[model samples]
Target: MQSLTNRQKRFLKSKAHHLNPIFQVGKQGVTDEMAKQINFALEARELIKVNVLRNADVDAKEAGELLQQKTGAELIQTIGHIVVLYKPSENEPTIQLP
Candidate 1:
């Protein structure tokens, strides 16, 4: 995934503002199952927020990188315990990033 421009990042940040974390990285860290689910979510939603549990072995940043590597999604940012990801859809893309 390519790096997002400031404008694109701002656009995505606003779009993600109200989204809840549908995926969570738990104590087990970024497992295959989690990566699969994340891929599914990205395929469906294009953008998603992932919550990193407090007791998780990996920090939010590490978990974000792991997910990025596994799912080939772009890591928008890791804020607090939240990891935000975005991947432009292969078919019908929804986000028209500036």
Candidate 2:
């Protein structure tokens, strides 16, 4: 997939406005298991939010980047403890970026 444009980022943020975080990174940070779960969720949901708890060993940005690298998902945004990720499904993408 190509890099998301500024407009695409804004569009994704709006689409994810009301969605709750599907995964949480705690003191363990972005474990492989957590990345797997996130990848699975992204395959099913296209766009998803992840929350990095305050007590997490890693910073929100670090955890988000780790997950993005491991899961091949794009980090759309990181607001406070929340991280937004997007990866279009190969077979059937659910979110159409602008």
Candidate 3:
């Protein structure tokens, strides 16, 4: 996977700020089904936010890493229970950076 440049990363972060999480990781957290859904979402939308529920035992960083590894998406940012990720679409991307 290609790494985002500092400028691109910053741009993506801002673009994702107002967007709500497309998927939520709850107590079950990062299940195989969840990973598969995330992968599909990333393919349709280049940038997406995942909300980690408070009850989940896993730390945010660990969850983010696992998601990145499993979905082949870049970890754009993580604040509180919210994680932002990016995976450029193979065809057309729904979200565009400035």
Candidate 4:
């Protein structure tokens, strides 16, 4: 997927604002199974959030980047322990980019 532009990122950020984290990263870190689940979620939701627990081995940013690579989703934003991710759904795309 192509890199998201600043405007697109901003738009995704807003679109994701009302969403709650659908997954969490803890001591196990970003497992392959977790990545797969996230990938599926992105294909369905287009945008989603992941939360990093306080006891997580990796920080939010690291977890976000790892997931970004694994799921091929754009890292929209990271605030504290929350990681926002976005990807256009292949089957039925919902969120349109600016």
What TM-score, computed on C-alpha atoms, does each candidate reach? Answer: 0.95, 0.96, 0.91, 0.97
Worst 10 residues of 3 by lDDT: 89-98
lDDT (Cα, tens digit) per residue for candidate 3, span 1-98: 77878988999999899988998888887988999999899898788999888898776777899899988899999999899999989888766655
Q: Is candidate 3 or candidate 4 better by lDDT?
A: 4
Q: What overall lDDT goes with each candidate model? A: 0.92, 0.90, 0.88, 0.93
Off by over 4 Å in 3: 94-98
C-alpha positional error of residue 39 in candidate 3 after TM-score superposition, expressed in Å? 1.0
Least well predicted 10-residue stretch by lDDT in candidate 1:
1-10
Collision count of model 3 = 0
The order by descending lDDT is 4, 1, 2, 3
TM-score attained by model 2: 0.96
Clashing pairs for predicted structure model 2, backbone only: none
Report the poorest 10 consecutive residues by lDDT, candidate 2. Answer: 89-98
Off by over 4 Å in 2: none
Superposed Cα RMSD, model 3: 1.4
- Candidate 3, 96: how far from true, in Å? 5.0
Candidate 1 vs candidate 4, lDDT winner: 4
Write model 4 residue lDDT over 30-93, tens digit each, in one string. 9999999999999899999999999999999999999998989989999999999998999999
1-98 per-residue lDDT for model 1 (tens digits): 67889889888999999999998888899999889988888988999999999999999999999999999999988999999999988887888888
lDDT by residue for model 2 (1-98), tens: 78989999999999989999978899878888888888888989999999999999998899889998999999999999999999999889877766
lDDT, candidate 1, at 26? 85
